[model samples]
Target chain A: MSELLKIENLHVSVGDKELLHGINLTVEKGKVHVIMGVNGAGKSTLMHAIMGNPAYKITKGRILFEGQDITELSVDKRAKLGIFLSFQSPVAVAGITMENFIRTTKTTVSGQQQKVFAFKKLLKERMNNLSMDASYAERYLNDGFSGGERKKSEILQLRLLEPKLALLDETDSGLDVDAVRIVSKNISEYHNENNSILLITHLNQILQLIKPDVVHILIDGQIVREGGAELADEVEQNGFDAYRLAVKGDGNDEA
Target chain B: MKEIAINRLPVLTYRYLKTNDTKILFSAPQVSAAADFSDKTYVTVGAEFPENFEGASSETLAAALAGEKYTITIPSGMQAKLTIEIKLENQHADYAGAYHFLLQKGAKLELVWKLSGTEAAQGSYLASYYELEDAAELKISKLQADLAEATLYDQRFFKLGKAAKADVASAELGGKQVIVHSRGALNGDEAALTERTVYTGTGKQHLDLFYHIDHWGKKTVSLIDGKGALAGEAKKIFRSTLDFHRGCAGSEGEEGDYAIQLSPKAKNISLPLLLCTEDNVAGNHASSAGQVSEEDVYYLMSRGFSWEEARRIIVESLMRPIVDSLETSLQEETLEEIRRKLDAKGE
Candidate 1:
């Protein structure tokens, strides 16, 4: 398989402290690589760094997307390049409805104005598949959505955008059983033969559905282990206690 | 000018900005006088205005100078929608006028007032009055914009009968200097009144809003929700008073002022006062001014919007509550005006 995204020794910082200390990873085309980590493991830092969040400063290393360097591109430029990040907590934008936001973003990324009628039809179908209320299209973007609804909204974006590479940063983090099932289904639906996905989650419920092609245990900004799909099942059956005890002595930076 | 005496609140007056030698427009676009009132009662100016509400200098000056007076009365059980577009066509000319509307028992009236100033330097003064009979309903939606290098004096008075309801709202988008005064009396039992306002000040502008609502009847309900944003060296002052009389037992009154201070040099003053002569009433007032959130801008930027558009979204949210009260046909236009003002790089 060909490499869809490659990161070489990416060091990221917030303010004075560094979060990701010499991290390296890669995602291959048509593959779902899950990053299983405990809290404060720099999982989100890596995802945000990829999405070009200004808050996450990239101090060193390079990120190549589709054989092109995108380390210095703006967030919107990255989005235009089909790089999408599903935020753990989507910001609420009042007055701008969810439908407007989605359609405007799609237009910007596609470099064309999406027809309203056609967009509505597509949005309606996607909302129906997620069992979301049609009225939510007219409501403010995640203004007062519940936890499950917010997760569903992220999935809705993923399914609609169908980006080349998606960074699903805990898209299933705060979901109940039913919500988890729905989110997992949507996540699985977004993946295909032509695209790649990097799923960041500590929950095995989603892993049970997507059947990751590869799994990596990220401990303190470093990938401690990498294995096939079976690695996720092992970690699910037994928590990452071995890696936890080992990282205690590694002296990795606290996330 | 005989004397500019009434409405002389020390803080709201702009003594430095002098008006022209109070000249009356002998004739205005008579289209306002001959509105088709069959369907809406087609509410427009007819001929019924009192000489004064204790005439403020602006009112008296308008009456004496560019006086254009109109009055209209709707019979009982009649429904009317009054959509008035006040376009100051003179450019550099001054305008002054007065209007009064009376709704009989069970009558309903909805008024949408649009006021826009042209490219020339102009000044205007307008006074409007409304009387709603028992069980009558009245709604007022006013949109004012593009008044740069202009001055405006807008005053509204209302008298409600028993169980009558009134919803009055206005959106102030652009103006060099704008003064707004509103007073109403709920003289009947169970009368309800709600006032919604949105204002913005940029450049070296001055915007003043003064409102007083008195509950003279028992169990009356009154609310004043005023929201505004100031940028540049502009200044805004909001004075709102909700009064409950001794006989008005079981009444509820609330006043809230929310301001977005975009520039550190911009000044925002809020005076929310409540006078209750009755002990059995519930009263509350809140005033707050805060800076626009940079985090909000970053979040929107991540969504592909520019910094200008991101600030527009936030200001739109702040004004959405009042904008929603505008007529369906006017909502989009008013929003566009707000967006354009914010795009001018005013916080």
Candidate 2:
């Protein structure tokens, strides 16, 4: 499979504090890479850093997307390059309707003549898949949406944009069991249809629905261990105690 | 200094006034005021009233009509709508004046004004007295302006015999220095009043909006909604008072909320005052001013919009609901004008 993204020696800081220290990771096309760690393990920070959030400054690193160095690109430019990040907590945007926002996003990304009827039909189909009310497509984007609905809207965007590298940043957070199953189904469908996914999640319940090809244990801003999908089940059953021991035995290489 | 001819007579002038202020004011003098296609009137009032700022209505009318005069009358039981267009393109010339509208018993009136840019120290006053018999309605809207210094002082007194309604809306978008004062009075039972005000300021602009409502009747209802936005070094202060007299039993006065969007280096203050002398009346007020938030920006950006685009969209949407309430033609015109100003600001 072709490689979609490669991050080497990624060092990042939020304000004055460093969040990611000498991080490295790679995701290939048509693969699911699960990033799992305890709380404050910098999973969300790594995703934001990769997506070029201005708040997360990269002090030392290189990010290659589709064989092109994009570490210096702005978030919009990165988005145009087909790099998408589903926010952990999707923010509410008032006034702009969902239809308008989605249409504009598609125009920016694809620039193709949109068939209104066909687009609406497809939106309706995907929304049904995510159990979103049809009227949500007309309502303001994420305004007054329930927690589950907001996450569903994020997945809806992913299904619409079809980005090359989809970074699902805790898309499973704040979702009920039913919502998680539906979102997991949509994520799996996305993997089968197009693009790779780097899901940064703490819950293995969603992992059971959409199996990960590889599971990487991240601790204190560094990947302490890398293994197969079994690694996720092992950590889920045994917790990260052994991994934390391994990270500590290394004499804290980051220090 | 130059000498110009007016009404076939030469007049001495310094620098030059870029606007026909007389013609603009004459076009809309009162509720039924209309431009006289056959006869034109000129009036000008020039007296510095910085301290107490009070002058006679007749004296202010005479200055603008020194060259010519026209009259507009709203008769009993008659309701009329007036549209006035004022355009100014000069500087260094100070324009001052007042216009009067006398509404007879049972009369109703609606007035709308569209103002363009003008030079420094221009002042305006509009006084309307409703001599109502029993039931009457008056609706008014004073819209946009681009001026160096302007004051729109509107004094309205409604003589309510039994039941009357007053609807007042003032929407001002651009100007250098503007002060708008609106006073509404209800003296009859079962009377209703609604007032809506919106203003936007940029650059070194300063705007002051004061609204005073006095209720004297039982079972009176009043509603007020005000909104504002400021950019650059602009500053705005809005003061609103909802007053219920002692004998005004069961009267309800609701203060409108104002939201101000401040760009860098902008300042804003809003004071909504609720005063009640009667124990049975209901009165309340709320106001706020703040900048854009990171989360709002992020929500837009994540969906493929630039920060600038997101900010513009939010601000435009903030006023869209109000603009939608206007007539279709007026809404389109205002939207077009706002677009032009936004483009001028390089947004």
Candidate 3:
């Protein structure tokens, strides 16, 4: 199968210390790749590096999207190229209604103004899929929304955007059981419809609902271990002890 | 009685005048005399405006309205919509002066006015006074924009009777200088009043808003919401006050406020005042005036928007409380105007 996204020996730094050190990975089309690690294992940094977040400086790496170098593209350009990231902590924007925000994102990506009725119809359908109330459409985006509601709103955006490659950044980290189920289901639905998925989460519970084709263990800013769906189960039951021990022996290779 | 010192300044610059409309003709002496009101009733709309634009006085009601007269009588309780258009016929300054409007008892008036092509320090004033009988309701709205170089003094005064309600709002979008003063007095029991103003200014613009709510009636209620945004070197000043008279009891007032400063030099001064003399009355005000926070901008930029785009979103969001208040039909048009004016300046 053709690769949808490829990151080669990626080394990212913030100020003086490096967050993501020498990481290499490839996400094939029509596949879900999960990364599991401890709190500071650079799990989220890789996702931000791929999304081209300005704060994360990509010092020594090349990110290829659809076989073309996209290392220097802005976040918006990356998004227009079918890359989406669900933030771990979504910011609340007062006065901008959810409907308008989604519509703006849609039209801006396509450079075409979409009719309100059609956009509303799509929003309603997506919200229903994510178990969100229609009233949420009129309220301002993420303003005064509960934790579960914010997660669901992000999923709703994921489904509406239908990005080719989605970077789910700890979407299931703070969610409760019911919320996890719904978010997982929405991700599964999006993966089924979209081109690829890159799930960045510490908890393996979400992987039970949305199966991952490949599981990678990231430790000390490096992807130390790579395996199939079974890797997620091993980490879920035994934790990152075995993987951390094995990676320490390997002397921290970049990729 | 000592005569109130009144200054009548006539500075006409706009050459545009409506010749086909007989009401626009300059009936200087008549309009000025009509404005000299001691105790009387008068209703005036367009068409009755003076034709001789140059002869009209920009200072007093007599010269501005050109002695134009229209009699409007509302039965005990009635609702009506009034559209005020400041149209120009010629591109000349003689007709480009200030204007005024006043109202009487038992009348409900909803007004919308358009302004444009007013050169440096040139704008009009709609000084209106409303007298309400028992249970009267009035709403005054003004939409000002398209200014070559203009300023607006849209001052409104309201006197409410028993169980009367008044809603005064103005949405000022495109103008060099805009000063809006809306005041209301609830003199009778159960009188209600609401005054809201939204200003979006760019370039070298100045918008001053003064709103006063006087609760002189028992069980009266009032709410004042003010929102504004300043880009470039534009400046905005908001002064809101809620006063509870000695005899008035059981009155309440609350405020919802926000402002976004987009430019480094942009200034916003918000003064919210509450004075309570009656023991049972409650009044409070809260305000914030600052540029879009650096954290918010960073968060937005991290989400794919550039710093400039993020600032635009913050400013746009800051003004949304007001933008969303418009009628559905006028939303797109208002947004278009906003986009045109704001975009030209490249926030």
Each prediction's DockQ? 0.33, 0.38, 0.33
Report the first chain's TM-score for all candidates: 0.95, 0.95, 0.95
Q: What DockQ does candidate 1 score? A: 0.33
Score every model by TM-score: 0.86, 0.76, 0.79
Off by over 4 Å in 3: A15-17, A94-96, A111-121, A241-255, B1-73, B88-108, B118-121, B245-250, B278-284, B293-314, B327-330
Which prediction has more favorable lDDT, 2 or 3? 3
Which 10 successive residues of model 2 chain B have the least lDDT summed?
B4-13
- Better structure of 1 and 2 per DockQ: 2
Score candidate 3 by TM-score against the native: 0.79
Candidate 2, residue A93: the lDDT equals 63
lDDT by candidate, in order shown: 0.79, 0.69, 0.70
lDDT of 2 by residue, B83-137 (tens): 6555444432333333444456677766665655565435444433444455776
lDDT (tens digit, per residue) of candidate 2 on A80-174: 88888898888766656787778778877775757788889989999999999899999988889988888899899999888888899999999
- List candidate 1 segments past 4 Å from native: A250-255, B1-66, B216-219, B244-254, B273-284, B345-347
Whichever of 1 and 3 has more lDDT, that candidate is 1
